[model samples]
Target: MINWKYCIIGAALVVVLGMLFRMMFEYGVLIGILIPGVIVGYLVNNGYKNGAKNGIITGIIGGFIQGILVYITIDLNLPPFPAVISYILVFALFTTATSAFLDAVGGIIGALIRDKI
Candidate 1:
């Protein structure tokens, strides 16, 4: 079973840390993605039977939020039309997939460690 609470918490942390690193130190967004990935990994691995799925869920939430922020920050001066929607969709999909892959890897590693110890 998926735990929504942990996923939301993880996503919140990702956004907060991501923005902080992005604004404060000029660090890459991947660093922000990575921290929450580890966190979601740890959380999901605790009770869930499928770490990858949980991680994907967590990533989707965090990535969606992050992607929206990115979209808002970017000065895409395209005409307000269907094109804007397409752009947002594509951007959202890309971010979500990337984050999901990274988070899944982290989740698998976390699950392994949890099992071992």
Candidate 2:
């Protein structure tokens, strides 16, 4: 069974940290990959599969929320609001799809390290 609690927790953390890193550094995506892993690190005890699930859910949810937040906070300078929204959504979907795998890999690696210790 999937652990929604950990997923939500990881999502919340990744969203916050991801935004901050995006503003402060050039390595946002690279660092963001680890946020989910760190947030779900405790679940390593549950196994790599569980860790991966939690991380992917976190990435999906967090990516969407971040997308919405970006839409609200930044002006795309597009003439049509709908166009801006659609572009934001498209980019969000792409970002989520790309990041999900990295997050799962990070989760699995975290779990392996935890398991070994």
Clashing residue pairs for model 2:
none
lDDT of each: 0.73, 0.73
Q: Please report how far candidate 1 places residue 88 from its true position, in Å.
A: 1.4
lDDT of 2 by residue, 6-80 (tens): 878777876787778878888785586576765585574678888788778777887777766755566646657
Candidate 1 per-residue lDDT, tens place, 52-96, comes to 667778788888888778776774576587878788778878888
* Model 2, residue 109: C-alpha shift (Å): 1.6
Off by over 4 Å in 1: 24-27, 46-49, 76-78, 115-117
Model 1 lowest lDDT segment of ten? 43-52
- The clash number for model 1 is 0
- Candidate 2 has its poorest 10 consecutive residues by lDDT at 70-79
Candidate 2 deviates by what RMSD? Answer: 2.0
Candidate 1 Cα RMSD after full superposition onto the native fold (Å): 2.5
